[model samples]
Target: MLETEKEKVKKDAEALQLKMYINGEWKEASDQKTRDVINPATGAVIAEAPEGTAEDAQAAIAAAKATFESGVWSDLPATERAAYLLKIADKIDEKAEELTKLETMDNGKTLREAGYDVGDAAACFRYYAGMITQPDGHTYHVADPMQAMVVREPVGVCGLIVPWNYPLLMSVWKIAPALAAGNTIVFKPSEVTPVTPTKLLEIFEEVGLPAGVANMVMGAGPVVGNEIASHKDVDMVSFTGGTKTGKHIMKTAADTMKKVSLELGGKSPNIIFADSDFETAVDYALFGIYAGAGQVCSAGSRILVEESIYEKFLARFAERAKEIRVGDGSDSKTEMGPLVSQEHLDKVLSYIEIGKEEGARLLCGGERLISDGLDKGYFVAPTAFADTTQEMRIVQEEIFGPVVAIQPFKDEEEAIRLANDSDYGLAGAVFTVDGAKGLRVIKKLRAGITWINSYHPTYNEAPWGGYKQSGIGRSLGTFGLEEFQEVKQININLEVEPIGWFEK
Candidate 1:
């Protein structure tokens, strides 16, 4: 690369770095406090973002309310709304490289994974764009022959809180549907990985969304996030994060009777039966537990294997775990990267200690990788444990890292029982060659989504949520769009007579 080209690239990266976006303008937080964004791969400060405060959050909510009241975004034709969303998608596509680089720099995810997430974000908006004008309602006949129609309307201003694990994808997951339903939005990107959304806001302007229709406020949970949840002007709050935080958002939203939707924590199960294709099941099991450094909310961190094949499976699984490359996310050869932050790394390490105290057998990779060449980053070796009992801490709690706990179940009934024993019911997978057995297992599973003979397969058109503590309300597909809307019924009578003398 030439010197001029290198300078241009540096300038481009700097231009994409952001402080905050309130209303229609990019500005610093009211506190003027800034936080350094670290490259998880190297533990070096790469950029700084304004640490937003409660005042900035209130301003964002006010902007959303003002935009809604002005009727600029609300009164636009649904087709025009859809067009704007598509344009946003186009803009994202244009800046894919920059967004992907920023995500990898901020979140410690591989460029490949970040690139794919950015693409998924674009696809989500495009999918919602087509759905914006398609919310047609149904009409029914009445015994009195009076006309009646049901209509779906936007649910006013929406407060979206995204998680750090999949920053861009989670943002799109909430933002796309809320906008599709004609709702203006005030969003708070997770402080740990705020870069992608800031880049997204830059694209929003180029795409020509009306002022205040879309906004971003960057800050921590207690400050900006709480304001979004409790603000009276914000009619709805959709959050994706930990269960503890999700509960707080739910409680705060209740103060104002605001609508709330949450996609919270999961201790999802991935069951591998004796009859499954051993090689395929092993790969699926690995990916389920280890991908994204196992930060995924729906990560299948618990592995339930048939007792008959448990020993053999453990050996192969451990062998594969050793082969997983742990290094900089920028390296194409690297299969896994560091966890998002040192705090998260320490938390996961604590859980590993608990697993040992509770007597679960540590199979392999329990310690952090402290090579002389790589000392600064927050890196943990991909970990796996076998002989894990249901009561073991590792088996029961969510170790959101490259950690997997294997428990051997005796039979189909026992497998189902163990899988549903957790407080979460987000996603699960059953690997079996027998078609009837796979279907039967899926039927008995308690999760909202079950994958048979496969794992982690999701679609933009499928409804996603949980059956129990995993979450309330669904996201993705047409069902996702409905979460940001309320239903209204309209009636017109062609011929009606006044019951009394007060007819006009």
Candidate 2:
């Protein structure tokens, strides 16, 4: 039955065309070009998506712009807009199985992880739907004769670019709030893993999202992403990707002075103090960097251990890292799957070599793994490096792979310093039993999100983003809803009086 279910999912995904959705219609690229969507697990072509160009992006932008300006969606009451989002959430839940399979097949993560991501995507939409109806704006009274009010309104058409990792979940992080807040959207899923987002557009279509309200254009970053960022019609650009791309988007969007929110790269620290629950810290330390094959932007790739426990922890961690089961995504027993693509696999492997060249000791499992009858898939064993300095590239840079750099610190001050040493400050974790000490360490960490005694757990209700080069603005929570909105203030005069000082 398990094999049968797997076969069914594989069939369904292959049957899909993976086309773009623009102006309420499924369509191909303007030039009629297509690209193969490869399954990273097997290096097979699971489906084909449009190799969209700037012209295709223009169409999507125009659709979004026309829809927003039409006010068909934008003029609706917040509750009315929210109802549609709630339905999208429901639809997402209904199609969870199919979406999960496509996601796993496309991105090469375990099916279990993909399913969780699907559930999170649904929850994200629901969270925004409820938030949209809550009392927004504020009223203030200056005097008996004067009153003032401030209201939140949508920021016109928005452009959202999500990374290949966590494609659907990240897309929902931007799409849900943008839609619930009454803004139309032109969304670009990473060309590398466009399957689930393609599936999401199908759901949007089935749920009857208004024509031109939401659009999908799939292609390389240069063509699709660049057009969306620089397009005059798009009012805001929200991107989740590398810091370099985020910077490019920021600069491009600046031509029109558009609002830009970026959730970019990270080299976050996982600090394991000797005072913490030893076993729990060890487990999470592995989870933090190994989960998602460390493609996650908030991945705790830099681990700082107290000097006393450093050697002991390193030995245990390396031994456990070697035990991780890496195989095909379809295999129920597989703990980790392939990297997303051959290109990414090569990039990660190169980083491993660079880590060695930079003098970081490879404790274990730095090379690619090919086994279990899988030769073409991109698989890397979870790697741990010890005897690392703060200045080493492996410690400082954001290497988005299942490779972690372990360093030892003398005390609390040194740990804090090491954690804050990187240019990326997306997320960090502090493991300590003493509540006051944990809190103190958290306060000193420069990351946007800090976990105490845990790592890599995020809630839909909590804002997610980063500081420094880890990207700007926040996603999720009420703050996320506000990201797509513009605040407008109005003043009213209760008394019918004309100001003599004003020349009428």
Candidate 3:
């Protein structure tokens, strides 16, 4: 067959065979039910995934527990653990194109973004693979003159729940570190976008990870996700999603007294000072929110521009926002794509309405676009609202769409106050020319990760989580590795000790 024919055949095959992986096996849903994975750009069905149930989640938990108890994964040498993660990374690299394409089809993100996500997923595995061999344990000097040491051991049977926005990357964020720390995992991918994870399981099997060491079950939060969070056999639960769902997971894990790590919602603020580099700040501010269709948890959705440059910034920002091309993710020229679902699209639209009602000026876009050929897609024009107040719903609530609200602040104090006024404080950004002012603002900003003149620049080596409702505990870096471990102290006697005077 010709190369074009082979390519067509591959795409066809990807659209057909959607399965769920549970207990290290790929199978159809027990009820044979399937959910249609829609292409948000065209509002068309891209694929079908098995609609998993609570029973599937229970089976996956059982499998993970049994695998952890078997000691194969735990007893494996750190080098061996690193080798397995490396193998998984290699498999991901080999299937990068397939995974990226699947993500674009299912998640309504641009091909460029999906491509980046695939690379990031691989890098996550590779990073954890390298970290597994690092020295872990601390040595302490005791005043009592006895040798004291503390060691970290794996907490068994972790439950990972990833959100739909960045399905593959988020899963890797949880899976790599948990496994690197010597814990087996039962992962539950979002039911709305489950194709990439199903393919990921095939890669795990191809890479020869032991059965049940890594498992995935697809279902909604109420069913599969809740079961994983509440399962008695699960030693820890790491979740990345909305704040409300994170709360539910925390509550459920509390029943079992399981360790929980959450990376939840954010209404992050991007404070652009008058003295900052206007062009750079504008660019970072736009990408921080509009990238990924603004579904990111750390998206700088709230824009706090200094009053001196408020008008100047809004004009340029709105112009740039209007230039963004909203189209199908498969198109290389498309800069933005539709929101994940019609419901989410409507929610965003309602927020726009609320913004208007709350008296924020709709400076650029306020409604869905109905271009000549774009009527069928769930496309919203990249929107900008000027004169937004901190009390406005658009400024306070997370729209989670390509919608930005710009509010003017009198000075640094007001900016910091407005920035920290939200219930969510996952991340924030400070843009200014003066390094001193930037540092001072960062010190006062109540956020987990604060970017100085930059936004959304994350690394595997940095610890990530929030101070308040954004999350509990951290992920990535050594902090993330510690999340999967429990500390134990061993005290040794260097010399014989005398009895107490009273006893004598």
Maximum-lDDT candidate: 2
> How do the residues 57-80 of candidate 2 rate in per-residue lDDT, one tens digit apiece?
998999999899999999998888
Give every collision pair in model 2.
none
Q: After best superposition, candidate 2 residue 12: deviation in angstroms? A: 13
Global local distance difference test of model 3:
0.87
Q: Candidate 1 or 3, higher TM-score?
A: 1
Tell me how far the alpha carbon of residue 58 in candidate 2 is from the true structure, in angstroms, after superposition. 1.0
Clashing pairs in 1: none
Give per-residue CA lDDT, model 1, range 23-106, as digits (tens): 789988785666667778888767667778899999988999999989898878899999998999998899899888888988
Q: Lowest summed-lDDT stretch of 10 residues in model 2? A: 1-10
Tens digit per residue, CA lDDT, model 3, 155-222: 99999999999988888889899999889998888877887877788888888888889988876789
User: What residue runs in model 3 are displaced by over 4 Å at the alpha carbon?
Assistant: 1-14, 143-145, 493-504
Candidate number with the higher TM-score (1 or 2): 2
Model 1 residue runs over 4 Å out of place are: 1-17, 501-504
How far does residue 289 in candidate 3 sit from its true spot (Å)? 1.6
